[model samples]
Target: MAEPVLAAELRQEAPIPLDLGFALHPGEVTALFGASGAGKTTVLRCLAGLYRPRTGRIRCGGETWFDSDADLWLPSHRRRIGLVFQDYALFPHMTAEANVAAALGHLPRAQRAARARALLALVHLQDFASRRPAELSGGQRQRVAVARALAREPEVLLLDEPFSALDRAVRVALYAEIEALRARLACPIVLVTHDFEEVARLADRVLVLEDGRIIAEGDVGAISARADLPIIAAAAEAGSVLDATLVETLAARRLSVLDTAAGRLVAPVIDAAPGARLRVRIPARDVILADRAPEGLSVHNALAGTVAAVEPRAGGLADLLVAVGAARLRAQVTEDAVSRLGLAPGRPVVALVKSVAVTRPGA
Candidate 1:
């Protein structure tokens, strides 16, 4: 694999001790998630040059931004990074366009406004260009902040709980917009968030941190399948992310057939053409176990598999990792059910999943 666009090895002593390292590839979104004081924000600060680490190396696109061993440190302004803070930090007195224009101050003053307008259009806020932060809605203000950050055309984008301040409805809308932005921009994006829903929908890879150290790290499916991570298992949203290709679309029934490693599965219709590949999330809670072949059921997908592992969780619950061919699916069931059904590794089983249970692409 090619070198990551953003690479960092960070260690700090003040405030909270942190020792962590990671690499971020282009066009990928890596989320840092944990409880408050888990050092998520600290990592972002170090990457942005806002906090110099006690010892570490930070590189962006092969450019050395910081190297404690070499006694090198790049100031925030010198490092090319676009940061969107939790609070939409727009200039209160400036219009949406003006706030974006402020970041383009290096350009000719006359050209900044037009460039700002173009960016606003890119973010679907062309009509709100003239409105000030105070006059605009929370979502519109955030769009302005995103535009302003992109005005620098940084090599990396950093988002720190950017949607936490917005209402649920508005946050959902921004989530789609951010995903759209990711498609248009090729830079590596780092997001800091405490919301698991946000992590489920926005993160291409997740890093779970605790006490200033990484407790778990992997793509969504791998992380979700591991029973050893108490942090993930406790969420109750643990599940697999399957990469599949749309093979057929049943327009009348509003369903699509996906070819996956586990087998052919049916799901709710996605707005993608046949042959297009997409990721679908299946929450462990949504899966059903059947020792025998199920019949007279409305569930659209049932894959034959064997029990791979069974883990007991709190509250008399158990998680079963089932291996179907080359793919693994996690199912959360009550401990009583496990005992009644006699489930364990090497046991034959069938996994039933509803068509609608398949999650949307970011999830």
Candidate 2:
């Protein structure tokens, strides 16, 4: 684990002064996650010298950027912090190369152009370096911003919703570019996002915040299991995003049992058993409601439960969230069917699912 290159204690006032503290080390990506006003941006702004806390200290590597009590405060420019914004924020009138060159203004013109070219090439936009922001696509403009931010080669990188404006495919490709950049750079990255899926894809660790306070922090795997995580993401994607441990291998029958929220679910042929955690996705659409426990059904994972909530899904589909054991399993059924089955907030129901469908993630 690389030591943090960035550190801070946050405060926005009142009951939760956001007395939060977190650090980032070389090559580590720390995701700042929370609701709209959880102070995620405030934390980033403070680090960027845009927002100053009444009481807090910030350090990058061995240099102390700010010490409120000690009266040490470095102005924004002196901190050497690179920023990537939600909007690409490239100069529309200038060519990509010029925009990138501007970021290296402190350097001589020739050296600045050389660095800009290198940064563009790093983002695979070398050929488009001369094009103005207006001539480029959304993704292209974003790459220019990234190149510009890197042109300065700061000690730390702070990105506030960098992928927000782009389409999914574009955002994903850009995020991959960032991950590659993360591998090559030594600077600690503080990425603020409201999307857990993005966090799962990009962050090494997550800082879960609410109401300008740090409520929880952990790896993506642990936080995905939280009941609320799924609601942010769709029920289909939420469940539990696990790396899946392989505990046992049943060679004779070519099957394995996975210890999951559905309890010891027997999975297909695998080299895991008992203690191994298997990656599985229980789609809300795949889960079905039953009135009673059938003796021998086609489905294997059956959970006896009571209807927790019956909510509307798009296109007349309804989500029947049932509380099974210690976890809530979501099933999508027609609203009419729910009405016909007399399924309501407190009605008894069984969640049925096929084990074969619970394959490995992306499998």
Candidate 3:
């Protein structure tokens, strides 16, 4: 495992009881994911030095930002962190260039302008540098905010619901921007978001928070496969994320063939050239489990796997985790179907999925 660039252990009793510990490594994006009032923002605040927990310690890049036992504390400005808020939080009177330049206080005054312009260009907002927040579109404004945050050359980047304010189209565009930024930044990025799609699209790891506590922590696939968790079960679209590489595209059929750890998968045509890597989402509800492979079916994919777990949910539904080689697939079936199929741990099964049901994470 890579060494953690940012590590924190925080505890508090009032306002919202929180007891959480996690670490982020260089170039890793760890998402603090949960519904509202889940202490996601509080954790971000604690890391940024905006909110001090009653007890615990925070360390980043070999520096102790907070140490309760040692009576050590660092103010927000003293800690090198880049934070992008949901509202953009740019000065209304200042142009995009000025706003980004304001964060270059650590550099010599003569160098601030050049660095600011460079950062703006990094975010593809160089042409909009003279526009104020009100004069720019939501997406452009967000790009400026990201540029401003990068101006600090922070050791860690903190994003608090940065996409919640934007529409789906804009959010999708920003998702690509963030992915591009990730390639250029070596800093650990922490994102606080309630959207599972956001977690699927950008996060390398997920920390599932519930009522001020982290109930689960793991990679996106593992966490999403745990349908037993209330948060996972309650998601509008509960699914497993798979890493696949496009092998072929049947343009006429409007389908794409991808190879995954589990097996070959056929998904709706993805707008990418062959050999392109992609993250695909397989919703639990769309998966159909069969004791053996069916001879003829409309399903385009049937992956062989063994049952790892069977979690019974309310409404006569049961969630099954099927271990398909090194990958896992989540399926939701009726309890009666489970009994009829004799589904249990160690049982071999075939997971049937239609091409239309499988999709790219942010598609």
Candidate 4:
């Protein structure tokens, strides 16, 4: 891995005990994923210099931001970090342009306005420059907040549930916008969120926190496939994330065909052009296993694979990891089904997935 652009080792005792360490590489979006009160936000705060841990060291871009042993602390304003809060923290009276310009205090007065406008244009909000936060929709307001953060020319970007306030449709649109912005800004980005779907869509890596400590950390696909982990097992949306490319769009059929490492899949019409890369989420509950191909069925996807593992769960349910080509698909079935199908590691099986059940995260 390349040298980490941002690194931290934090330790605390009171008000949510925390003991964790992590590093972020340039151009990598690492998510602090966990449930409420799991200390995801607290860790983000410590990194942003908003809260100092009892004993910790924070370094970014080869500069020390905090060192408890030396009793040295760099205040939030001094740290070259851009933060987008859960709530759009824009001044109600200020227009979108003014809100973004407020962060350009470090630049010359004459250059601030132009720089702010450029930032807004980057987020595709150039026309809303004169609109105040109250006049803008939730998604528009969030975009303004993002534009303001970019005006700081930060070395690291921190997003704290920035899309939580938006509805599903708006959130999906913002997901695409953020993905575009991320490619342009090659800085390390840290996202604090509890939504697994959000993590699957936007995060390159994930650190699962429980009781203020990191319980698991890995690439999003690996973490999502760990049914043995409490967090993954308990999530109703437990599933596998596959990297796929849009092969073509069948407008007449109202479906899009995608090619994945596992196999070809047909899904509901997606809004992207052909050849676009996408992340597809296949919920475990939506997958069915069969010993051989079924003659007649409405299922659009039937991938042949070998069983990799079986994790029995409460209520006699079992989670199976089926390896298809280079990818894995997770399927949840009853223990009875597992026995009847003679399911076990190395057993050949066919995984059935419905066209409508296949979802593109944030779509």
CA lDDT of each prediction against the hidden true structure = 0.86, 0.75, 0.89, 0.89
Superpose all Cα atoms of candidate 1 onto the true structure and report the RMSD in Å to 1 decimal: 2.0
How well is each residue in 6-92 modelled by candidate 1, as lDDT tens digits?
888988777778888999998899999888888999899989999887998998877999999999999999888999998888999
Sorted by TM-score, highest first, which candidate order results?
A: 1, 3, 4, 2
Query: Candidate 4: how many backbone clashes?
Result: 0
Name the TM-score of candidate 2. 0.70
Better of 1 and 2 by TM-score: 1
Error at 311, model 4, angstroms: 3.1
Model 4 quality (TM-score): 0.90
Score every model by TM-score: 0.94, 0.70, 0.93, 0.90
Tens-digit lDDT string for candidate 4 (46-126)? 988889889989999989999999999999999999999989889999999999999999999999999999999999999
lDDT of 3 by residue, 1-363 (tens): 889998899998997789989889999899999989999999999999999999999999999999999999999999999999999999999999999999999999999999999999998988988888999999999999999998888999999999999999999989989988998899999999999988888988999998889999998878888777888877877878887888899999988898887788898788888888778888888899988899868888998899999999889999899999788888899999999999999999999975334333332
- Candidate 3 residue 108 C-alpha distance from true site, Å: 2.2
Q: How displaced is residue 276 in candidate 2, in Å? A: 19
Report the poorest 10 consecutive residues by lDDT, candidate 3: 354-363
Which 10 consecutive positions of candidate 2 have the poorest summed lDDT? 354-363
Better of 2 and 4 by TM-score: 4
Clashes by residue pair, model 2? 3-25, 4-24, 4-25, 5-24, 245-277, 247-273, 247-276, 248-272, 248-273
Q: In lDDT terms, how accurate is model 4?
A: 0.89
Over the stretch 245-265, how does candidate 2's per-residue lDDT look in tens digits?
455657797776566554555
User: Weakest 10 consecutive residues, lDDT, candidate 4?
Assistant: 354-363
